[model samples]
Target: MEKLLVIGLDSVPPDLLFGKLLDSLPNTKRLYRDGTHGTLETCHPPITVPAWMVMMTGKNPGALGIYGFRHRRGSSYTDGYIVDSRHVSEPTVWEILGERGLKSCVIGLPPSYPPKAINGCLVTCMITPGPEKEFTFPQSLKNEVRRVVGEYAFDVTFRVEERDSLKRELFEMTKKRFKLASHLAREKDWNLFILHEIGFDRLHHAFWKFFDPDHPKYVVGNKYERIAEEYYGLFDELLGDLLEAAGADVPVLLLSDHGSKAMKGAFCINQWLEREGFLKLARPPLGVTEFEKAEVDWTRTMAWGWGGYYARIFLNIKGRERGGIVPPEDVPALKSELKRRILQLRDVSGRPMKNSVFEPDELYGVARGDKPDLMVYFDDLNWRSAGTVGHESLYLSENDTGPDDSVHSMNGIFLYHDPNNHQNQIKSMNAEEVAPTILNLFGLPIPDGMKGRAVKLS
Candidate 1:
C-alpha cells in the first residue's frame, strides 16, 4: 500500500468513534462499520511523552530510560529538555521507514523533541507550556508553513485548567495543520502519514463530566449538553474531513495513547509505605539542628501524574534499585511487606485498593528486564502517582481547582481501517506494543531490544 494515515487523537475515548456519536458524521461511522475497533493499554504513568516514545521505539522505560515529562533535573535548565528522538533508545518508525526509502509525514508527535533529521516531513507536538516553535523539522518546510497555512498560535501551551481555551486553540490549529499535512501526504507521496489532534485527551480531562456517567458535572438538561455534544460533533467532523481529503485508497488508523477516568481523590501510596515501615522517615531532632530535612507533610503529600495507564510500587533495594539504599539481605522481607502494604492502600476514606496494581509478573513478562519493581494501578481517573526514589509525599489534593484540566485514563478510542490480518477486535495493546506493531506493519525487520510482538496484520 502506498498510503497509511494515522490520527492519534490524544484522549479520545473509543465510544466517540461509534454509537450515538457516529450519527454526527455518516462517513466516519461507515469506517467504523467495516473497520476493527478496540481499546489500547498505555504505559505506566500514562504520560504523553513517555507513552509516545515507547510506542515509536518499541522499548520499555527500562530500556529507553524515560519515565515522566518533568524530572527534578540536576540543576541544568537546558539539560531539562523534554524527551525526543535524541533521547529515544531506538530508531523511530520514521527513521526506519526513511531507511526503506519511503517518504513519510509526521505532525505534532509528542516526545519528538530535539527532532532528528527525518527522511520526510517532521513536526513536534505537546511542547512544554508553549507552541510548535520549539520544533526541529526541515527549515524549508517549517518556514514555508507560516506563509502557506497562515499564522499559527505556537505560544499556546496545553494546560488542564484552561480546557475550553486549549480546545479552541487546538481545534483551530489541528484544522490548519491537517490541511498542510494532507497536502504533504499527497504531494510528498509518502508511504505513511501521521496526524494528531491531541485535543481529545485535553477535552476529556476538562469536560469528562459531560461524557462520563460518573462525573458530577454531567448534566442531562438541554443547557450543558452542548458542551459534550458540540465537541464530539466537531471531533467527528474533523476526522471525516481528513479521511475525505486524503485519497480514499489510503488506510486510516485512529488511536489514543491512553484513556482517562474520573477522579474522586488521591491515595497516598507512600503514606502506606511509611505505615508499613518500608520508607524510613528522616525525622528532625527535637533540639537545634542546622540541617533539618524538609518536614514531609505526609497527610497532604502525593505522587501523581495523569495515571489512567498504571503505577508501580516495588521493594526499594540496594544494588538493583535505581539508587540502592536498602541492603541486599533486607530485600526479601521488604518485598513481602511492600506487597502486603500495596494491597491495603486506602483512600482518604480508608477504602482498600485491593489488587489495582497491574501485577506485571503475571500481565506482561514481570521478569527483571521487562517490569517495574512494584507494579500497580492508581485511581485512573484523576489520581496519579508521583515522587522519586525516596520522597516523603505521595498524595496531592484532589480538589478540582475549578475548570482546570488534565488528560486522564478512562477509555481510549480505536479504529483500524484495513486491519489486514489481525482482527482488530476490541483488544488492548500496551504502549510498548506500538513500536513492534508499526515495524511489523511495513514488513520491516524488528529491532533487537524491544519486548513487544509485532501485530501480524497480514
Candidate 2:
C-alpha cells in the first residue's frame, strides 16, 4: 500500500517558495527540481477556512455554505457565529479513505476545533479556543501531545506592536507544531497524514512589510528585513526533518490554502455605504465603532456590508429582515446599481480603484447558507474591507481590526513529489483538484460531485 503525506503550509505564496528563497530551502528546492509543482488557484473569497475545506472536499465555498470565518447568522444583522468542525457537512478526503479502513493522522486542519473522531489520530486547528478544551480526537491523544510538547500552541497573537516578543512566540509556536508533527509521523500508523502549519500565515501578516521592499510602509533599513528568509529557512529545515520521519518512499504533497501579499490599506466599507446613502445611521458614533454596535436605521437602509479580505454586502429585503425596506422585486436592479457604483469608487488619491463585484448566484451556481448579496474585492484585494464606522475618511492606512500587514491572495503553491514517478512539470492546478488527486493516488474512486480532475503522474 502506498502512503501519502500532505504538508499544508497556510498562506505560503508561490513567489517566495518558487522564487528567490528556493535556493536556500534545499529540501523544498529538491522537491521543486524533481516533482510536479505549480500555483494552486484558491477558491472564491480566498479565505483560510473555506479555502482549506474546499481543497479537502473538492467543493466550492457556495457548495460548502461557508462564506468566511465568521458568518451572519440567518438574517439578523447583529447576530453572527464563528465556523467550527460542526459546520462541515461534506465528507473530506480522509473521511473517504477512512471508510476503506485506511487510517489518517490529521493535525491543525482549520475548523477542526471541536475535534471530531476519525479512523486515526486528530489534532484541531488554530481556531481552538485554547488547549484547556479537548483538542484531540479520542481525547487520549491530548495526553500524548502534552507529553511530546508541553502546552501546545494552536495560534499566536501577531497583530501586536511587540516585534521581538511576537517573533520569538511565532518561531516557538511553529517549532512546537512541527515537532509534534514529526513525532506523530514516526509513531502513528496511518496510510494518509496531514499537517497544517499556520506560522507562515502569521509570519506574512506580521513581517511582510519588513521584508518586501515593494510594501508601501516598507523602510529600507528595517530590522526585520531578513525575517521572511529566516522563517522560510526554519520551515524548510523542519519540513526536511518531517520528511525523514515520514520515510523517503512516501509521496509528499506540499500545498497552501491561500497566498499572502502586503496590504495597500483598508477601505471603510460601512463609512462608504453611509456616504453613498445606501445605509442610514440613527446617530453618528462619537469614535470608531463596530458596525454591529452602531445605531443603524435598518428601516431606511437599502444595503449594508461586512468587511474582511473582501466585502460581503447584504440587502434589506422587505418581508425578510426585521426592519426591511427594499422590495424583493427591486433586488436585481438594486444589486446592479450597487455593483456599478462600487466598481466606480476611487482611491484616496482620486484615482479609480480596481474593484470587482459578484452576485452570489452568478459566482457560484448555488447560493447557500448566509451568503452575501454581493461580494466586492477592492483594488483586486490589495485593499482590505473595513467594517467599522466613525472614521472621518473612508480609507484607513491600517487594518480596522488589527495591525495586519498582509492580505490573502488567490494563488498559493502546490508541489507533489512522488519518488517512484517524478513528473517534473510546472502547471497550474485548481483548489478543487487536490482531493480528487489524493483519491487517485490512493487508487480510490473519484467520487461523483467532486468538481475536479486528477493530475496525471505517469
Candidate 3:
C-alpha cells in the first residue's frame, strides 16, 4: 500500500495559487503542473469545525449532527456548549485504518479536543483548553512533543486589530506546528500521516485587506500590505519541507477546509430579528455583551441567531424548546417567510445585499435537532453576520468579536500527487469525496455509510 501524507491548511484560496502569488510559490506551482489539483467545494455552513469533520468522515454535517464550532444542545439557542470530537457520531478514516492494524498520526485538526484513542499518536486542536492539559492520545506523547519542539502549538491567536502581535504569533505557531509534524513524519512508523495548520486562516482573517486593495477597508501602501503574500511564501516553503520529510515514494494530499475573502462589515442578525418582530426582549440591556445575562421573552420570540464566521438562526418551536411558540404544522410557511424576508434585507447604504438562506432540509436533507433552522451567507460571504443584540443599527463596521478583515468563502483547495499513479487535471471535488478516495487508495472497501465515491486515479 502507498503511504499517504495529508496536509490540511485551514483556509486557502485557489486564486492565490493561480494568480499573482504564483510567482512566490514555486512548489505549489509545480504541484499544479505535475499533479491533479482543483477547487474543493466545502460543506454547507462551511466553517472549520464541520468542514474538517465532513472531509475526514465522508459524512455530511447533517449526518454528523454538527453544523458549526458550537451547537444548541437541547433545542434552545442559549442552551448550547462548545463542540468536541466526541460529538462526532461516525468513525473517522483514521479509526477505520487503525482497526486493520494501520498506524497513523493526527495533529492540530480543529474540534479534536478530548482526544480519542487512535492507532497511534493524536494531538488535539486549538480547543484543547490550554497547553497545561494532557492533549495527546497516548497520554505520554505530550512529553515527546515538548522534548522535540519545546511546546506544541495548536494555533495562533488571531485578532485583526492587533496586526503586529497577530503576525508575530502566526509565524511562531506555524514554525512549532511544522517542526512537530516533520519530526513525527520522519520518526514514526506510519501508513497514514495527517497534520493541520490554522496559520493561513488566521492570516487571511486578519490581513486580507492588506492584499486586496479593492477591499472597502483597504489602506493603500500600508506596512502590512504585503504581509499576507509573504505568509503564503512561508506556507509554500513549509509544504516543500513536509513533502521532503514524507520521502520520494509517498503520495501527498494537500487541502483546506474552506477559503476566505475580505469582509466589508458585520450584519447585526439579532437586531434584525428584533426589528422584524421575530425576537422579544424584556428590557434594554446595559451593553451588547450582556446577552448571556439578559432576560429574553422566549414565549413571544419566534427566532434568534448566533454569530461567528457565519450566522445560524434557530426557531423556538412548540414541543421542542423551553418557551416554544411556532407550531410544528406552521414550520414550512414560517421558514419560507423568514427566508424570503432575510434575502430582501438591504445594506446600511440602502443598496440591495445579496445572500443565500438555506433551510436544514434543503441543505442537509432533514430537520435535525442540533442543526440550525436557517444558515445564511451574506453579500456572497464578504460580510459576517453578528448575533449580538442591542446594536444601534442592523449593520456595524466591525465584527462583534473585534475587528476582523476576512470571512470564509465556499471554495477551498484540493491537490493530489501520486508518484506512481497520477490523474489528469480535475475541475472540482467535494469535501465528502476525500475519505472514500483515501480508502480506495489504501485498497480498503468503501464503507456503506459513506456518501462519497472513490475517485479514479490511474
Number of the predicted model whose lDDT against the real structure is largest = 2
Candidate 3 Cα deviation (angstroms), residue 118:
1.1
Question: Could you give me the TM-score of model 1 versus the true structure?
Answer: 0.77
- Which candidate order results from sorting by TM-score in descending order? 2, 3, 1
Q: Is candidate 1 or candidate 3 better by TM-score?
A: 3
- Tell me model 3's lDDT, rounded to 2 decimals: 0.84
lDDT of 1 by residue, 1-458 (tens): 56678888776656555654667766667767677667777765566756777677776655565655643233221123345456665677778889889887888787665556777877766562343454636856766667657764432444355455665776687667667666666667577788766666656656666556666445665233455556666767666677766776667777777765565544455444555554544563343211113343333222211222345444434454344456778655655665665666665555655445544455444332323455566543455443322323345444322343344563566677773443435555667777677767677778777778875433
Candidate 2, which segments miss by more than 4 Å at Cα? none
Give the better candidate number (1 or 2) by TM-score.
2
Segments in model 1 whose C-alpha atoms lie over 4 Å from true places: 72-82, 128-134, 153-164, 217-224, 270-325, 355-375, 379-382, 386-407, 418-433, 447-451, 456-458
What lDDT tens digits, residue by residue, belong to model 2 across residues 69-120?
A: 9999999978999999999999999999999999999999998989998999
RMSD for each of the candidates: 5.9, 0.9, 1.7
**How many residue pairs clash in model 1?**
28
> What TM-score does structure 3 among the candidates reach?
0.95
TM-score winner between candidates 2 and 3: 2
